[model samples]
Target: MTARKIIHIDMDAFYASVEQRDNPQLWGKPVIVAWRGNRSVVCAASYEARKFGVRSAMPAVRAGHLCPNAIFLPPDFPRYRAVSRQVREIFQHDTDLIEPLSLDEAYLDVTENKTGLPTATQVARTIREQIRS
Candidate 1:
């Protein structure tokens, strides 16, 4: 059987990363993007905030306690959706076999990619580098 090459990419703390990317002030800060309410849950926590044990699905108040210095911001779904589209477009450029798990994650089947890369790992690395750039 022929090998079916697959590549998975997941953006770290997607919402928080978008926030930080768009706002210089948020860069390097522990950020938690979620709703604001007594019963609210975290949506995304930046790596900086994760250092203090903050995580998604955790209660907002608990996350605050875990990272006292963490900055809480409400999620902007529209903005996230827009960015997700952009990422999808990037994937579409290489292959049509893209499956998105979420706005920040996806699987790409690149066994026969347009770029003619030698290996799936190379394709994955290129895609990641493109996203990072």
Candidate 2:
């Protein structure tokens, strides 16, 4: 069997990242993507929010209590999907052997890639540059 080069990309705090990307005011602040309700749960929490002990799957009310200044926003799947597609496009530019696990993560087999990159690390760097650009 041929060896495989698997790269796992973490679309870290995806929902919160998208929200921050779309709204400049959310930058450098605790951002939580979840509804504000007694029973609502956190869909995603930004790194800043995480510092305050907020995490995904946590109750919205508890998140608030943990970080009272945290900015809460409802989940936007459409925009997330669009951004996720853009990310996938970047990955596809390097390899086609991609297995999507979720909007926030994926496994990419880059043992033999279209870009002819020397290593999976290089491919990941290129993908990150493309995403940033």
Candidate 3:
């Protein structure tokens, strides 16, 4: 019998992270991905925005009220999806036993990995390094 090694990886604030990475102007600021309409809600909030109590599914208006300095941008599904695919590719370098839970999250079975990492934690470390570069 063999023990199973499972690893869960989540891209923090996926949309906002990609937005910040692409737009230098958004760096080091509160960023919220949401439509600019009265009825719109927040799709994702960067860590800076989260510090101000902003979060996913919250009313955009309220988010603005909570963080007046937050830069609000509409959700970019195509870009986000592309980034998700890239992340998946990174995961694939280590293991094929991946179950995607969301655009930003997945579960990986790393008992046996293509990368030959000693453990799931090492596999995760390599994946994170790849994603950052």
Candidate 4:
């Protein structure tokens, strides 16, 4: 039996990454994307924000305390959905065996890919570059 090669792609911090990608002002700065309320949960935190112990599912208030300089932005589901579709399309170009877990994460089976890539790592790198572009 032929072994199937699988590649997992997960954006470091999806919503936050999207925000940072779109807004040059947020680059290299801690970003927390979520609603702001007395009782609000964090949807995503950028890598810079994570450095301050911020994380998803944590309360917005706590996240602020963790990273006082963290830029708080509301989640933009529409933009995120658009980016998700783009990533899905890129994966489909390489293989039909694709499973999406969320906007930022997916699994691609590249054992027999359309791209004819020699290794799963190379496929993953290509996908990452595509997503970034």
lDDT of 4 by residue, 1-133 (tens): 9888999888878899889999999999999998998799999999999999999999999999999998899989999999889879999999999989988888899999999999999999898888778
Error of 4 at 133 (Å): 2.3
Point out the higher-scoring one by TM-score: 2 or 3: 3
| Cα RMSD of predicted structure 3 | 0.9
lDDT tens string, model 3, 20-104? 9999989999999999989999999999999999999999999999999999999999999999999999889988999999999
Predict model 2's lDDT versus the native: 0.92
TM-score of each: 0.96, 0.95, 0.96, 0.95
- Residues 1-133 of candidate 1 have per-residue lDDT tens digits of 8798999989889999999999999999999998877899999999999999998999999999899989999999999999999989888877899989999999999988989998998888888888888
How accurate locally is residue 66 in candidate 1, as Cα lDDT from 0 to 100? 92
Candidate 3's C-alpha runs over 4 A off are: none
| TM-score-superior candidate, 1 or 4 | 1
User: Model 4: how large is the Cα RMSD against the reference?
Assistant: 1.0
CA error at residue 20 for candidate 4, angstroms:
0.6
Global local distance difference test of model 1: 0.92
Candidate 3 Cα deviation (angstroms), residue 110 = 0.8
